[model samples]
Target: MVFDASARRRLAPYRMYPYLLMTVEVPSRGITDQWRRTGLARLLAEEIALAT
Candidate 1:
């Protein structure tokens, strides 16, 4: 779900308790640098799924 620009509380803290095993793909350094420029250092669950 794409959100509007004025959505309230767009950013929040993420905590993983007793973490489960999963295949995690780490983005490349170049991608991370680009995100930092755009203030997108992290992503929501839905956004991550969409990205994959």
Candidate 2:
């Protein structure tokens, strides 16, 4: 999925200063493991909350 400039702008508030680009490609198992190992999902949740 991709976000357009406007969408990215909308998320600006939740984003930390000095935006960084990170790309991750992992197997389903790895994704699940990381989901549990780190609170990555919360980051998305927080962004969405701020967008609202």
lDDT of 2 at 6: 84
Question: lDDT per residue, candidate 2, 1-52, as tens digits?
Answer: 8888788777676483322222133343355565433454466455655555
Query: What's model 2's lDDT at 49?
Result: 58
Each prediction's RMSD to truth: 11.2, 8.9
In Å, residue 39's CA in model 2 sits off its true spot by 0.8
lDDT of each candidate versus the true structure: 0.32, 0.50
Clashing pairs in 2: none
lDDT of 1: 0.32
TM-score of 2: 0.36
